[model samples]
Target: MHQLLSRTFKPTFLKIYNESHLHNQKLGRETHFRVVIVSHEFNTISPVKRERLVHKSLEHELQAGVHALSVIARAVDEPLDTHTSPPCQKPVV
Candidate 1:
């Protein structure tokens, strides 16, 4: 999958997380993953298009062992602020 994404998108920041451990039941193969891809290629593309590109790139992997995939694709210039938020303070009772 990493190879496919590298070849297809040439991402600046590509993080592939193997999340198969979260799944209790096995689904044929142990290939559940989460991909966080940051690239200039996605700057001009729509969200759906970005997902399609990923899916197209991993077509072979999808057929082979991969089952579930969660994709978080963004342009290289885009900051990952969404993943980090200010801590919430507890209210006094």
Candidate 2:
């Protein structure tokens, strides 16, 4: 999956988190992911577009088995800010 994203976006820095442990999943299984992608491709792009680009790149994996993907796509020139999300409200099915 990292290979796919790297090839597609050519990110300067990419970090992928397997966050299945935060839900009802076994260790080492892939069902939820958080992606921190920094790339020149996102320069000046809107948040929605960044998400769209990422989603498009991971379309196959999302369809195959990845239940959730929390994307934090950033531009190389963008300012750094702490990103936080509310805990999962719905129980993992």
Please list the C-alpha lDDT of all candidates, in the order they appear.
0.77, 0.87
lDDT of each residue in 1-93, candidate 2, tens digit only = 899999998999898888887776899889998888999989989989998989999999999999999899889988755365456667559
User: Which residue runs does candidate 1 get wrong by more than 4 Å?
Assistant: 25-29, 81-93
What is the TM-score (0 to 1) of candidate 2?
0.86
Clashing pairs in 1: none
**Against the hidden reference, what TM-scores do the models get?**
0.77, 0.86
How much RMSD separates candidate 1 from the native structure?
7.8
67: Cα error in model 1, Å: 1.0
What's the count of clashing pairs in each model shown?
Answer: 0, 0
